[model samples]
Target: MSIKSKPTLQDVARMAGVSSMTVSRALTKPDIVSEQTRQKIDHAVRELGYVPNLAASQLVTRRSGIVGALITTITNPILATTIETLQQGLARAGFHMLIGETRFSQEEEGKLLRAFLGRQLDGLILAYGYHSPETLELLQAAEIPVIELWDLPEGEVPRQPVGQVVGFSNWAAGASAGRHLVACGYRKPAFFGYDDERENLRFQGFRRAVLDGLGVEPQRYKTSAIPSIEDGVDMIERLARGELDCDAAFFTNDMQAIGALFACQRLGIAVPQTLGICGFGDLPIARVAAPSLTSVRIPAEKVANSTVELLCQRIKGEEPWAANIDVGSELVARESTALRR
Candidate 1:
């Protein structure tokens, strides 16, 4: 099929019986054009399904009005909430969001970074933490504001980022889960989650916490792919059948923790009594899970608020009050790790 040519300002002008300048004025500054002219242009635009050229507006303003975001996935609630809030804040500040999926890989992010730079993004927000050497060079060369979200890289939770970081300590979040389990009197514990760059950071933190708090390192059961409910359930079944030697477990997130609950029910493994489970992210379901999951809470909205503030400062060529901000985290004690139960 032959493709129809895109309707331009000239085409709209022709249909409305006006000059291109008149059509532009009607679309942008309607008050400068007569009501009759605007009505004619509007009718023409609707009939032709003409869309406004946002690129032209960007060129004139020297601001792309496009903020590029690289997130692992929209399926995960933590990243999804932060991305949605970031978009809303950017929109309020007269910017649009263009998102790229990275799936927590530096390689995937590197490709998306190149594409975003080609698109002339005004800023970038990243959910994934790792950056390849080439990706770092590209970002440094681009000289645009980049906000790294989610977690700090290489146990640099307290280190101020060179660009800007709007995240908490992934290690610390995981550590809290481990420490809480130890406090609940669990002698043996396991760590089950995705084996990725950031998840490794969590694993490290959890191990340190478990070793220090209970003098025992957690048994690691990891997947190279993204951790899902199915992975959690299957891992739990294995543990239930005496496959993994651990009495309690801390998962990377609540989905897996809840799945473990199902496995326990199926295998008649008593939670807290025989097995204690803790999770990260403190998702809503954690509170309502069969035994109420113990989890670490990251403040998504609070992080978004800080991210937008930093972006706005950078956009206006002003230094932020602080280059890196730790939004902080909390541990939600729940029935799953109850000491009395």
Candidate 2:
């Protein structure tokens, strides 16, 4: 067969020295076919670049075998773990995932959702809970199993989730970091992060903790830019220049915290002594940084497993035992925040 020509099932079977029915059974129901014959069919398909007609398969099975995932950005190391795990889990269950970057915009998310819906995906997995009204309406109309990640409302019913929700409380994670800073004997802590709604919840929790523990409100420093190491470096530089007044700072994620640590070293500011630092999302670098970072650890794998399990259940026309699953977060104490009182 010419490599440029579209290969068919007969071509594959002819190359593999098997009948068309045997090749079909091997591809669709391999368990019933002998291992030796299945290997020949696979080798022939690979050589010919044969692509199965997913349209025909879907028409018969009523399943597209595809899931759509939307996230803020692929650059954030913190979210990378969850996405990798979700992809692996979905692939294990014979489902392929198509991912889109929303860049934290409702308009972009809605556009991606519409594109995915047109393909008739079996389900969708979203990074955060908040969505545009149009996006919500689309999900309602699609009526497929949807899983929202990263911001579960604690003890309160969510207005979204046409299906299941799996995530931790951002507010709680921030509060834990704030209390950790207080325990380290730092006063006048400040929040340094993005101005997104989810980031705002973390700031609110951190503020509540600082107010209760230190009897003073923490300062707020925010930017609309996505949180990055450069942002963290700039924040520390501002503090050194007296542009901000705070003894400690809680950042949005480990990237910022790691950046702050590097900046402190360059500026001669002693961490946990002259300035304390903490961050959310205990990315791998947090454990190995010079002073190490104090951060909140989100259960990425747990969330992934639960999300896949629930989504599969919904796909099977079964209701999940529970709609909301809060895997929760934990504060990891480390050298960066180990201030001596």
Q: TM-scores of all models?
A: 0.82, 0.89
Worst 10 residues of 2 by lDDT: 154-163
| lDDT (Cα atoms) of all candidates against the true structure | 0.81, 0.86
Residue 283, model 2: lDDT of 90
For candidate 2, list the clashing residue pairs, or say none: none
Best-matching candidate per TM-score: 2
**Model 1 agreement with the true structure over 1-341: per-residue lDDT tens digits:** 99988988888999999999888666654556887888899999999999988778777867777889888877777777888899888876757799998776778888998999998888888776677889888988999988888776456454344478888878888788888888888888788878766787788888998899888668999753665677778987787676889888888877777888888888888887888888878888998888888888999988998998898789778978886788888999988888934
Candidate 2 local lDDT, 232-319, one digit each (tens)? 8998898899999998889887888888899999999999889989888899899989898989999888998899989988887886
Report per-prediction Cα RMSD to one decimal: 5.2, 3.0
